[model samples]
Target: MKKLLSFCLGILFTSTLVAGEVGSDCTFKGKKLSGKVQFVTSFPDFKVQIVDSFPDLKVQKVNSFPSDCGKWQEVTSFPDFKVQIVTSFPDIKVKYVDSFPGVP
Candidate 1:
């Protein structure tokens, strides 16, 4: 009985750890992180921080065709998502790259 209880506890802990991993599917909290993006100062859909390394997602700024994961097109109007740049307490951390933009 003790062995079975221990096994169940182990499985529960492992599942919780996996559930906390973010941006694996280019989405965070059910919101897609790709497509046309807008930078805002207030009331953003997501708060982001730019980091040099160990990013949750590697982003590539594109002029057009921001279709894939981590590809973002900057736009002023009708944005698919809005992000606020924050130095601290960000929802996600990202790094800008020229190539290979996706979950790291």
Candidate 2:
């Protein structure tokens, strides 16, 4: 009985550890600039998608190491539509979001 209990506990602990590991890809979906640009467990801090409108610039989240998210011009004006950068993820393609507005 003790062995079975210990095995169950070990499995539970292992699953919890894996669940705590941060993911490498995901996007945000909601109004831009409405909430803090913070990391959520389900979403990758390194990538996000603004649903209501496009942010003028996109930034990537780095995990304690230097990252090359690239230089993005700060978004001073918010658009009125949702946007997703289909060509890239986890890295900031500076001009990618800008192309969203011109999509025909």
* TM-score per candidate: 0.78, 0.24
Identify the runs in model 2 with alpha carbons over 4 angstroms from their true place.
Answer: 20-36, 39-104
lDDT of 1 by residue, 1-104 (tens): 99999999999876644323455677997878789999999999888889898888889999999999999999999999999998877878889999999988
lDDT of 1: 0.86
Off by over 4 Å in 1: 1-21
Candidate whose TM-score is highest: 1
